[model samples]
Target chain A: MKGLIVKDLLLIKENWKQLLIFVLIFIVIGLEGNQILTFVPVFLSLMVLLSTFSYDDYNKWNSYAVTLPNGRKNIVRAKYIASICLSAFAILFTYLLITISGMMNHHLNLEETAVTLLGCWSAVVLLQSFMYPLIFKVGLEKGRIFLFVFFIGVSALLGLVFQNIKISLPVEVISFLNHYLVIILPFVMIILLYISYKISEKIVQKKEF
Target chain B: MNAIEIKGLVKKYDDKFQLGKLDLTIPKGVIVGLIGENGAGKTTLLKAILNIIHIDSGTIKINGEDNKKEEKKENIGVVLDNMFFPEILTAKDIELAMRGMFKKWDTQVYYNYLKEFELPLDKPIKALSKGMRKKLEIITALSHHPDILILDEATSGLDPVVRNEILDIFLNFIQDENHTIILSTHITSDLEHVADKIVFIDQGKIVLDQDRDELIDHYGILKCDPSQMEQVKKEDYLCYKKNKYDVEFLVADRDKTRKKYPNSVVDKVTLEELMLLMIKGVK
Candidate 1:
């Protein structure tokens, strides 16, 4: 498992220049007051994590990988571990960039930044929770195409639900939920990540190369 | 104990291709060359042994344990054709990754091999030529000090000099009486240089498995005139190919066939001739 993680990390490092360019472009956008750019780096990091799969597939590495000791299990586990690590780096790096941008613009709202960071992190991680199992089940190329269509369908369904329903919550209930959401969301994401890991493990266990 | 044992192995790729209901046992401390044409199930058989692909109904044992056991994989090294690390990775990175992957990965041994082969440690695999990449894969497999090496087309696509260098390494590896190797290739001459045994597969089934010396010394190709073809007994030749000018027979017992047909031409059968006759010749 450790070896697999090291391999992915090394692959990412090989593309460090590309990643650095992305970071710089996103930082410039963030400095220009495009707060939405905060989420871009994390999303980019996930894409980087996913690109490793393409690399493996290109070389048919997975077929060779399974011949190694504990390969099937370790390969799956390592991707998730490396993902979490990449997510952590992106979160921290984005936070630092936002801080610099905020201070320069005389709008250093640390509390708001923290909330946005949490929401962005959760969104990206949750997206992966849905993506990893599909990737494991089908494959990276097919999985990405499937995910694009799946998400579009999901967004349309959710849009329809919200457009038809108009329910206003009480101020007290809204405040209560918002107050506890920061604490609740992390646990929820953790559980989702665990479930996603389990599904991936199951897929890998039955997978032929 | 045999190094590997397969019983009733069957892998169905589709309606057109399937491997086995096959049985094979390879004893320890010898090089077994697996010879077959493309799509002949050589790769499939090796994949089945490595448990890279799930078998339909079979049991593969390596060193007396199920091939699926993690411990059994620890001592086996493999170089599957066109399958390896991502080309973006350098040899140094591979060493680091393999260190954690294999419990017995020897960095010293790996570096020694790289130095001996003149493989640059810092160059990404993509930058290296085909021969260099192959050498890297081979040394990576060897660095772990595996008891058994299973290679699929490991020597293909290289110049003769590079192939010779790699074959020499394989020969040196087998000097350890505890080591075993199963090399699958269509390059029969490579096997002729190092293999102790040859196992030929045709159309997904093993057609021949015998000691190399026994095969080379005993097998012969007898060429005879069309008029003299009647004198050649069907039982004497394993297979025969009839042409306009002469009738060629693949006889398994060269000395016996020569004694039987003293006036006929009986030449030594190379591995290539043996495979060609066995697959392309008539029964």
Candidate 2:
């Protein structure tokens, strides 16, 4: 697993210039007082980690990975670990950037920032939960298209649900669900992510190079 | 114990092609050449031995342990026809990656091989020529001191000079008595120079498996006309091919056949000729 992680880090390092550009772009946006855009850095990190799969596909690295010791299961586990590590890094970097920008601008609300970051993290977890199993089952190319469609469907459903709540649900009931959702969503996403990893393992185990 | 023991290995790929029940043993300390034409199940057999592909029904043992177990793979090194390194990585990065992956990886040996092969350490893999990439792959495969090296067409695209150099490295690799190699290629002449044993597969079946010397020295292709061929006993030959002008028989024992058919032209066989006759000739 350490070997797989090191390889992925090296792969990401190859595209460091692009990553740096993303960081600069996020910092500029944060300086502009766009609090919501703070999540973009974490999202970019996720995209970068996912791009490693495209690299693996082009190089046929999975075939080579299976030839190494502790290959199959470790390879899958390494992806998950790397994803978490990069997300942590991205979150820390963005948090520092936003905090500094907020101090200078005097417009940042700490509690609101915490809630938004938590929401972003949960969204990422849920996205990965759906994305990984798809990638493991079909592969990176087809999985990317499926992921796009998945996100569109999810957005449309959320939009419909919000519209229904605005039209039909009373303010007290809506606020009650919203108040608890921030606390409960992370736990639910964690459980779903765990299940996703297990599913990925099963899909990868039966896969042929 | 054999380096690799495969029994009843079967892999089906749709209706037209299937690797039927097959059995093979690769003894330690010898270079076993797997010869086959394109789409002849050579890669499939190698993949089965490595457990890269799931078998339908069979058992593959590597050094007496089940091949499916990840621990058994630690003893094996593999080089597939296509290069598997990310183009963005340098040879140095590969060394770092491999050091973490293989417990016995020798960084010294890896660098030594890179220097010997004239592979640029800092250059990205995509910048290297085809032969250089092949050399890098071979270096990685050998640096860990794997007991069994399985190569599937590892030398197909290289020039003869480079191929000869790689073959020399293979020859040196098997110098350790515990080390073995399974080289799969259509380049029979390369096998003629280095291989100890030859196994030929055609249409997903093993047509011939014999000691290299035995196949070259003992096996004979007897060329004769119909009347002369009639004079030779049918049971003396394994298989025969006939044309309008002459008849060719693949005889197992050249000395015996030569002595028995004193008047017939009994010539020693080449691995290429043997493969062709076995695959194309009637049984």
Candidate 3:
């Protein structure tokens, strides 16, 4: 499992120049205090992770990988571990960047930055948790297309429903949810990730490369 | 003990092709060459032995343990046709990853092979030529110090010089009395130089399997004129072909057939001729 993670990380390492360019672009655009900072970094990290899948596909790495000492379960486990590792790294880097930027601009609010970082990380992890099982089932290429269509369809349906229906949460209910969301979100993320990993494990176990 | 044992192994793809109800036992410490034409289930058999593809029905044992058991596979190394590490990775990256993946990965040996093969340590695999990539894959399989090596088309595309070099490596590897190799290739010439045993698969079945020396010594092509061919009994030859000027028969025992028909020409058979006669000749 560690070997698989190391392999993915090594693949990511090869693209450092491209990643550095992205960081430079983020730094320039982020000076305007745009909301892109938190989400973009998280998304960037996820894209980096997804590219590893593409690399694997292009080289037919999974066929060779299955022949290694690691079993199918370990392969799935390593991907999830690597995803979390990459996400955490992205969050920490963004946190430091935002803190330093905010300090330089005389508008530092560590608490607010923390909340935003948490939200971004949660969103990325949730997306990844959903995406991995699908990728394992249909492969990275087709899975990405399915994800795009699925997300667009869901968003459109939700948009139509909200546009037609008028519902508002009470202030107390919203505040109560807000107060506990940080605590609850982590548990939800863990459970979702676990389920996703299990599904991927099953898919890969039966998969013939 | 046998290095590998397969019983009633079967694999099917859609409804078009199926590989067995076949059984084969490969003894340890010898190079066994698997020879077959394209789409003849050579790769399927190799994959089944490796447990890369699940068999529809059958049991595969490696070193007397079920192939599904991961521990048994720890001492096995493989190079599947056109399958390997992502091309974007350098040899150095492979070294890092393999050190963690294999418990007995020998970095010193791995680098030694890389140096010996003249493959650059830092170049991405994509930059290497086809033969270089194959050499890398073979060396990677070797660096783990595996007790068994299973290779599918490991030398199909290389020039003769590189292929000879790789064959020498296989020869060296089999010096250990415990090491075994099952090399599948359509190129029969490669097998002629190094194989101890030959197992030929055609249309998902074992057409022939025998010791290399015995196979070469016993199998022969008996060529004769049309009238002379008439003297040959139906059961005497495995298969036969009719040419424009003469008729040719694949005889199982050259000396026996020569004695039986003194006037007929009983000639030695190459691996290629045997495969062709067995597969393409009329029974």
Top-DockQ candidate index: 1
Interface DockQ of each model: 0.81, 0.78, 0.79
Per-residue lDDT for A136-189 in model 1, tens only?
Answer: 888889999999999999999989988999778999989988899998998999
Q: Between 1 and 3, whose TM-score is larger?
A: 3
Q: Tens digit of lDDT per residue, candidate 2, span B1-283?
A: 9998889889999898899689998889999999999999999999888778899998999999999899667778889988487889999999988888898899999999999989999999999999999999999999888989999999898899999999999999999999999999999999999999999999999988899999988999999997776777879998888878998899999999989888889999888888878877877
Runs with alpha carbons beyond 4 Å of true place in candidate 2? A151-176, B226-228, B243-245
Q: What order do candidates take by TM-score, descending?
A: 3, 1, 2
Interface Cα root-mean-square deviation for all models: 0.9, 1.0, 1.0
How far residue B114's Cα lies from its native spot in candidate 3, in Å, is: 1.5
Native-referenced Cα lDDT, model 1: 0.92
Query: Mind sharing the TM-score for model 1?
Result: 0.95
**Segments of candidate 1 deviating more than 4 angstroms:** A25-34, A100-106, A161-176
Residue-wise C-alpha lDDT for candidate 3, range B9-95, written one tens digit per residue: 999998999999799999999999999889999999988887779999999999998998876678998998999999989999999
lDDT per residue as tens, model 2, A107-209 = 7787777778877888788888889889877889999899899889989999998988876779998899788988887789879989999999998899998
TM per candidate, chain B: 0.98, 0.96, 0.98
1 against 2, candidate with superior DockQ: 1
| Superior by lDDT: candidate 2 or candidate 3 | 3
Model 3 TM-score, all chains together: 0.97
